[model samples]
Target chain A: MNDTTPNSYRTGPDERGRFGIFGGRFVSETLMPLILDLEAEYEKAKTDPGFWAEMDDLWTHYVGRPSPLYYAERLTEELGGAKIYMKRDELNHTGAHKINNVLGQILLARRMGKTRIIAETGAGQHGVATATVCARFGLECIVFMGATDVERQKPNVFRMKLLGAKVVPVTSGRATLKDAMNEALRDWVTNVENTFYCIGTVAGPHPYPAMVRDFQSIIGKETRAQMMEREGRLPDTLVACIGGGSNAMGLFHPFLDDPEVRIIGVEAGGHGVDDRMEHAASLTGGRPGVLHGNRTYLLQDADGQILEGHSISAGLDYPGIGPEHSWLHDMGRVEYVSVTDDEALAAFQLSCRTEGIIPALEPSHALAHVAKLAPTLPRENLLVMNMCGRGDKDIFTVAEALGSKI
Target chain B: MSRIDAKFAALKAEGKAAFVSFVMAGDPDYETSLAIVKGLPAAGVDVIELGMPFTDPMADGPAIQLAGQRALAGGMTLGRVLEMVRSFRVDDQTTPIILMGYYNPIYSMGVERFVAAAKDAGVDGLIVVDLPPEEDDELCLPANAAGLNFIRLATPTTDDTRLPAVARNTSGFVYYVSITGITGAASASAARVAPEVDRVRKATGLPVCVGFGVKTPEASAEIAGVADGVVVGSAIIERIAAGEDTASVLAFVKSLTEAAHGA
Candidate 1:
């Protein structure tokens, strides 16, 4: 609470759990009392210090926090722009930073005495993370996925099944992540007594946007220390891709106070902005509306109906975004941009071909922006990119691009 | 003529069930929707239920969701929606219009503000999808203060213990979700709802209106055997979404009048 100690590094969630205009607890009357109870429990848990110590222990021993900030010297030399350093979240357990947030939420879910966990998944990364935690914690877990995603991401579906998560195939209109989200919400509404929905993104009503962001803050906290050790200062820009924006928010939170570090979020520009197939860029082409219990920007038609989003990357395809993201984009603090599927694929191939590292398509959009923006900056300048996830699950996509028989 | 009590008093004397029809206000476009709202009273639609479109319409099946999609596609907004409800009052003053949807939008709009605007626009009741009997304190109590009914849905999910609680909290009419699913899912059977209506009647003396899956005149007639009112949505929205003119649709609605009266 002291003035000298920076506000962002205080290591506790806000009194009401907000990040600028992004987080709050706007929920149903039935759920409001529960969220209030959660807020009180979380507040008390924070004061316990033991809970903080346990989170630290998991982050260090089981979940692996303070992941290395590796200098991409080879790629940095090739790109010939500013020095590039990658926050190795891909090296974390479960092959992405998604596990960190899931673990935290699962712990909290247990604390709230909820025994069942239900989630919605698009590309299946978050599903895998949720399934892993449910197995670890011995909780019954159900996952709702659009039928289309289940077909495209078979490996992840199997991974979830192996982890004992029952994946429910959603048959709603368009049969995608949006439908799965609707299905999960319907399940929550019908089973509010004992079931808890573990949302895969930093969106939905109030406390979720805030709670998920707080869990993801570990990414930013680790990168800050790692950067200070090697460069003796913060990077000039921080870039991350947004799909309901959990990964991006995770990498942006601890750095919120670093006024000098420019933050950029890349949204999926599917085919092109003009064609519906070309843009799932809610930030670029969305309006404010209420969905899944909170007010946020959504890609809706003229009559105010929510539209189905399209993207080459199944993971980034969504019609609406997190409410906090709508707030953040409006605040003008973080620069929001868009990248095409071709651009992301090209960047994915380049990073793999040049540096022996393949990135998930979601973060590749961010890398594509880095590919375009890094070389233009002065050599003395530094860039920090959250290499959120690996592309082990994208072999089918890679094969198709390579023109190989699957 | 002024509110639910007066309307029900008149209906009590006449011994008639309220003919409720659900429509997404501003479907396809604002003008067409306004026309339909104006035409409902003449068509014998006793209570007009206007659904406010939300992106994740969990309680709606494909047909009505598409109707909602068409309205949203036509550039209908919350502000325009309010204007449309206000527009209904311009032509008709006696009929009750209930604004129904998932709770997200109103919660986002600030409950007090939305309830006040809905009241000012002459809306009489609300059916919030995710709202249950346990959560009636927020929308139900506030809406009651504004003289609006916070109608509750009793589905197959409601057992004997919950049925009475739901009936106690609700007003205007208790909406019986005829099935466990969303609107427009299946054809309703009288067998499915007869016992439900009997249970709800024993639970409370409030007027009970049956909805969800009532797609045909025959279905309405079947529901009329037990419930006080019959609610229809998808069959009408399908007409609107398919580009049917209101005059023709209303003519079609007029045919269903015999179904409610069983004559």
Candidate 2:
């Protein structure tokens, strides 16, 4: 063990890409050099003012930056306790917070002279976002999605096709997010000459978790500033749903050093985080194991064979959580919880009926936890939940789940 | 010296390149898989690469991936894989057995415990595809400390500047991945792999074994001409997937080994 723990949680992932033995570059030798090159380029871009200048311009003009942090009056009134607010990242160009990280990675890819882009998606939100950006840059794009996801998320598949991306349906493993990522890694290893793998979540190898977190920190940064302007103080609590935990990491990373602010990450509880292994809550139900190039909490059998995670929301069906989330969970810096599918469904309906806003089932999990936790807190306690995605793409699934045919 | 080193030295003395064959333990079933492994040495294999099946084999193509699935479906586990090695050791002591796969199973089993178990089970070396030199401390160093060779792979993407790090702390012979892609995706051209094998051998001062996409006896011979050893995995697993009996699989491996040894 290193024995030396840093005082600040923000300055993690020491030079070796490790977040306290959680995240490291555990990739095949075939992609090591490329990962190193990317790390080097990202290091240079971190200090280059011109790089941030381009990112700022795109985030402002193209992505519609400063996504509103709106006061959820109806939700707060219904909960009968802590005031509620929703960070409106679902209003971004691609209708999800995934675009924020996609833009940053695409810009870096262009700087690296990579012309082909590859990505893996679960619910197709990230695919749509990546395809949209690739279309804007006129770069070749390919998205790997599980066949199961392709069948369910046909609309996003069509959208990606319309955006000129080739979507390959992976049929391996449980045919979900994990398999899609495997296929994408295979593509990346094969096409290392000119390909750039734009990972969707805060998972995968080292720089990716850190890079995606840095890009998505815009959510929390905006939330911090907006809360100050609206409430005259930082929110008492922060909540976000975690599949690969990108959105939660985004909203929580900027507030990690704020000891007064309580952080919570809600993971998908498919049936329940029980012995049956039906949930996507890695931190709550799983143990530390290496997969997809990093060591993190994963749903695996005793033999270390990764188990297929189930969730009503396709976006939250991954079997692993991001490394930083694992590190934070170990350090007790953040509280990790799980909400069942039924609870998330109830929250989804509640959000539509009360707030006049339809939330993707991924965030509905967070909303479910919020509904439970809000009533227990005092009236003056302020709570902020990330409305990370819109439910426009999930209407059919929601309709089917609610026993109403679309 | 380890069995791997002794086997390589014996091959060098015989003026022959070593032929390494890979098969997933418990593929189809335990008994048949053990039968195939036991038949490897008599079929002229100098080294054996026993695949510890994983759920997601990101570096593998369809053949090896299917083999892993079949093994997993047949109830293969880290313990069972180690048990298979122990069973193989009861009869064969001269042939080097190297366990190859992802890191999770061993990690789940606990690295130190897994290393000790692997050494006790007659596992002479390890070739974890995902563990680059950057993660040597995780398993490589421990395996090395436990007297097991932790082999490292040098790929086409592993350029001259990065060769030193890959070669450092590498105890066994270096594995030179002949292609930039996954296993069994494309055929490796000797013309393309010869210079790379030479580069890795020079950097590591270890015998170089070329693998990935070496499918046929002819290709095996071609690769063997340029490196000290040639590894054929997917091709052997393909025969197993095709439901060829142990004798047929052993015959197929014999042809490749004969070609490699002849070269």
Candidate 3:
């Protein structure tokens, strides 16, 4: 809206919802009208002071805004290089940063007079957050989870159920996140009249990737002011793990114009980024293609059939990343890297032992990269990573990985 | 003239709406699927819509989705689909064949090469579900340039304001999805479809074919009475998925085709 908007970072997508050719509304004719309506409504809501006031009230009172940027002093002292700071979004009401976007979307859903809410989940943190919001708002909620994910993330499934949400187990094609996403899209098209699809991450068509990022960008906004107030300068490097890339986008968006600040995104490298073992490292192993809704880097084969991405963490097992991340990767604004399951497991344990904080496996992937990058940089260089989620749901997974009975 | 254009013109001359049958290129296995495809035109089907099976068919319901999974499990790649068409073209040259599916496989095949090969293989048209008019420059325009009909879908949600854009650059026939849902999710009603079909015909001169929910002979007849053509996909796919033989499937297709022609 202003000419002073930075040329390097904030400007994107243009009017057609493209993030420099990465993001566009790639849905079917059945969904085209609904997507267009959503775009218009979101645009109107963006300019409405009433909408912002309602969102702020909920963020402050219900969802708990301004999650702390806690300094991991013990871990920093042990790493002996860059000073480590963790944006503790895990302390959010639903135990993850997912609530920040969920709260905003559900509020918008209420504003739009939608009666039903639908979502697709991988690790189920998002499902819980959505269920929590729908329960608070008294709207009907349905969450589609891959059958494999349902079996693994039992606690999150139960939490969603407790919040009065129906968790539908999707038993199609690898029975994972992508299939669940497909089922959610089907649901949205089928019930586009009264249903609002609250996408868990920033990967769907047009307005979703942009809208979800704006809602989640509170992470970066708070981190910016907090770092400025506490340390008098921005952190040199920002790190977050990407799986459909909401948390990473939330943490990276505000710092995009800060030319001096470097942003790094960590991806799940299941066993390794090799031909034999499967991984969800879309940027490193995948090429640009269309899936779900947006045109982005997808883990598709020679024939363009989507391949199931394997990851120790269910949350990071998606075959694609957000379209914005693809644009950033192409623009060379943010550095993207991958960490293996073993490395993430090590980081999960180390953080629990050193900092007394148990991070979800998704962010453990980011922590794994931090372990490597922190030691390489100077001790004074401020390195901040988003502790996007808590690890309670991952205990069974961790136990199995460690070859121990839970 | 292109087979699609000729077929529609013939239907228009005869005062009859066309009956289009859709089947996955390789369901159960490639050979049986090929047998079923070859038997379709003789079974009174006016047009053949062959599915290009993708790993993720987001817009399809259970019957079509399961059919695709079986096809993919049986090793039905894009190459195999084209092979099926080439083999079919050797015998039947008059019946229009449309390859319907998502865009990823075609994108991976290199659009120019895929369009050229589809044309060479006797494919008459395409109905890539995920590619809208906004993305026409990506595949639709090129496919059209290669002399292939790039058919577009019009839905219940395609308002008058949006109908023109959906109609632009569309050829062969306009696919009017009768429901606001995935394929085979709901039963289509002629009462709700007739006005929409009339509206779409006004937007584009291309003959509008109604699809997505027309499952039975009666439903086909009812829809055929109101539209230029009726496309039945999941119902035919349901028979194939139920282990029906080629003869039985052809009989079922004949019944629906007769219903449309008689209507």
Candidate 4:
């Protein structure tokens, strides 16, 4: 009842603890008081130089920050686009941008003096990322993944297990990303004292979306610096795939201020937007509502019921996008679009065939757009897309989709 | 005044929140859900949310989803939910009724036809979990104009950046999720819900009713003392799932409502 409108989220856990409309303590009642406690504790930890030193030391030794930005010489020539360079986040220690966020959260968790780590995974990318970090930091890690996703993304599932993390397959709902998140939230609410919910994407309640975005913003920072060094100026266009939209926002965020930079986000079209089996493209087809935390676009129905979305790629099967993406789409700062299953598959195969880089299905959706949009733009125009993750875990899906001959 | 707005305005003028409960229209059996519906008002429930059975409920937790499945299993359809609402309205003229469910069935039923059916059902409001606020350009505008209050769930994640827009479309009470997760999880706590209620109240003038983790009389009582209204779902469904009789469930809820009112 107090005017939480302004001080709801302070830039740094605020007076009442909120972060610029993005981070607030929007947890369960059981978890709320705990979060307030954690927020207080986190504030103390953040102020301690020992915490920063520990994070910096781990940043260098454990999860390899300052990941190199590699110029895709071969891809650029083949695609014939304006100097298409990758942020090389796919080369990060965990082979994806997921770690950038998890590493920070895990480190923050440790700083908060939490002994256990919990997270949810859609394609097991975030699970593997969280598991990998927990192993290094010596934190007890538990991951919740949808049962169906566990079966499909077997390699990543096994990888989480190998990394010494317990994987709890959520069997609720469609048993996908959203369900896994529900389980993770449930875990956090129950074990708020000893546990930390390392959100996989920039989509959860306050503090989470903002914190994850800040952690992942390294992608944007690196891209901006690398692009300036090579092109002497910012690129004209930017594109990234969006499930929960961390990678997209991470890449587009820093460049948001750049007027010349045309930002684009690609969503999974599943069979196609027209098909019932389409990915949850909230902007093009979805409406705004509140889910996880802040209000953004959600794939709900007439009665405001969240509907399960279908996507061929497990990575982009979620029903909501990140809050920042919602703002960008509404402001018309970003052009939000989608690509179909067949097109993304073709692009996934094309990236492998032409550029020798097998991209994740998520980025492949972006690739599909890149492939279509690249050749059309003049050689002077530049197009850069965040290759959020490597395609190592997508072999089975790609092979099956390509009609693997036994 | 619109049916829902008028009911809530009266409640608000009296300084009370509406306790809304949702169940699959044909959960277990059409007649059983019907009996529960008619039985709810006297049980101290202010509003009843009828979930139209569908094949998929993405936002629903295992409990509501299974309830939907059971309703579907018992040959529940959109039409049946409508019939139940119509029948419930015969005696329950004072209490408001809202249909909360997914959109595919209504989309399949045709938005115009569904709106007409809802109006005919004496339905007061709606809370379509899957219907995005953006898509309301097509659905909610019509639902609002047709004298239906389309309630939306505003969560902790929906910060000020997006809260204004989501709140703009809301006509009925805002269903504030107490957790960052799904419905029916035993994770939500009053400690977590209070700030959210505080946040949601800041976002809109609409009454804020918190749901998701409320499973006990103590929990509902605790939340009700703070929030404008308290929504208890999974606990009720869990009882139904566990084969608890409806009569006891209603009695338990009525007493819980009293507890919530600080009785």
lDDT of each: 0.78, 0.94, 0.92, 0.76
Model 4 TM-score (B-chain only): 0.95
Candidate 4 segments whose C-alpha is farther than 4 A from its true place = A1-28, A34-54, A275-277, B1-26, B29-31, B40-65, B68-89, B92-263
Candidate 1 chain A least-lDDT 10 residues: A1-10
lDDT of 1 by residue, B1-263 (tens): 34765666676678777778888977878898888888988888888899887767876777777777687768766667788989889877888888888765676666898889988998888888766554565578898888888887776656675666777767777788777556786656888788888787678777778888888888887887778789999988888877889898888787776677652
DockQ-superior candidate, 1 or 4: 1
Q: What are the per-residue Cα lDDT tens digits for candidate 3 across A131-193? A: 999999899999999999999889999999999999999998889999999999999989989
Write model 1 residue lDDT over A155-271, tens digit each, in one string.
999999999999999887678998998888767655666787888888865567777887898898888888888888888999999878988888887776678889999999888
C-alpha lDDT (0 to 100) for residue A166 of candidate 3: 100
lDDT of 2 by residue, B1-263 (tens): 99999998988999999999999999989999999999999999999999999999999998989999999998889899999999999999899999999999999999989999999999999999999998989999999999999999889899899999998889769988888899888977999889888889899999999999999999999999999999999999999999999999999999999999999
Which candidate wins on lDDT? 2
User: Any runs in candidate 1 off by more than 4 Å, and if so which?
Assistant: A1-41, A275-277, B9-46, B52-55, B61-93, B102-263
TM-scores for all candidates: the values are 0.76, 0.99, 0.98, 0.71
Q: Provide the TM-score of chain B versus the true chain B for each model in turn.
A: 0.94, 0.99, 0.98, 0.95
- Against the true structure, candidate 4 has what lDDT? 0.76
Report how closely model 3 matches the true complex, as a DockQ value: 0.83
- Each prediction's RMSD over C-alphas, in Å, is 6.3, 1.1, 2.3, 8.5
lDDT accuracy of residue A129 in candidate 4? 90
Q: How many residue pairs clash in each candidate?
A: 13, 0, 1, 44
Candidate 4 docking classification: incorrect
Residue range A1-406, candidate 4, lDDT tens digits? 1223332111333442232222233333344445545556655765778866876676667667666666666767777766676666777788888988887787778767789999888888888999999998788999999999988888898899999999998886678888788777666755555788788887766556666777778788888887788778888889899988999988987877777788899988887775363666877778765566445677876554567777878888888888767766665668999998899988888878866888888898998888888877888887788888889888878788888953
